[model samples]
Target: MIQRIQTIFLFLVVVCMGITIGTELWEQAVNGQSWKLSAFAVENLSADGEVVSSSSKWYIGALAAFVGLLALISIFQYKSRGRQMMLNMINSLLMVGLVASVFLTTNGLNSELGMEVAGSYKVGFWVILAAMVCNMLANRFIRKDEALVRSVDRIR
Candidate 1:
């Protein structure tokens, strides 16, 4: 029952991340605008001062990949308990990566452009943080269950 709930929650988190990334991409392609103000300048940077490559698409792709990976893990978790624990650990790490990316990207944008792009990034940051917390809670519950089973076996 608990595992089912955790799977549902993780699915929701993956969907939310996908939506957020999709929104950012739409903003970039349709509006010709940076998804977040901080992304604007970074997207414009040229490694050699002659070839400008935007990081926006790469970042969005990364998010999409992470979401896809999480969805796959969630689906497979039911088949193997060990895989479930591994997936939980991997998801937690992905959440950490998401948080770090949000902070660094936001800070990079803010320091270079002065808070103009903070709102979008802030929203993404908070959403990812909430997802991270949920993942952590789910992992703890699974660990507790494992411990309980071990204790019961020892008692017998």
Candidate 2:
């Protein structure tokens, strides 16, 4: 059961979240200066590639890590398809929240600096989307497995 297709999907979600944790989610270049946003913080870099300043964003990282943990836990719940599906659903909501938090933070950063244009999203942001897709796929397969089990029980 643990070797099912859903397991691979859930594993991909975990991997994506791990990548999100280490990479920048968004970035912007303004007036020859650049800012990079990661799960833990945002760093303002000067033209010469020096850290001009940094601001904390620990909550984003925490949420991403939580989603990853949920996926990992879901992987081991192979015996309970219903519970695994529930965990997948919960992970979906958390992923949405993570995206919202990143978007709001990026907007806040821009407004605080009086910038009219928005920054370009980076790998970390996209990775969340990929993880969300994988979560959905995992849920679908779990549902199919549950249905199959029910059908088999009826046949017996």
Q: Write the residue-wise lDDT of candidate 1 on 1-156 in tens digits.
A: 434666666666676565545443111211233433221223543333342445543664475467547755665566565577788788778767755665666566556545443434444445566677666666666677677778999999
Question: In candidate 2, residue 95 scores what lDDT?
Answer: 98
What is the alpha-carbon lDDT for the whole of candidate 2?
0.96
> Given candidate 2, what's the lDDT at residue 72?
99
Which segments of model 1 are wrong by more than 4 Å?
A: 1-3, 24-57, 114-122
Give the top-scoring candidate (TM-score).
2
lDDT per residue, candidate 2, 54-111, as tens digits? 9999999999999999999999999989999999999999999999999999999999
C-alpha root-mean-square deviation, candidate 1: 6.7
Q: Which stretches of model 2 miss by more than 4 angstroms?
A: none
TM-score of 2: 0.98
Scanning candidate 2 in windows of ten residues, the lowest lDDT window is 110-119
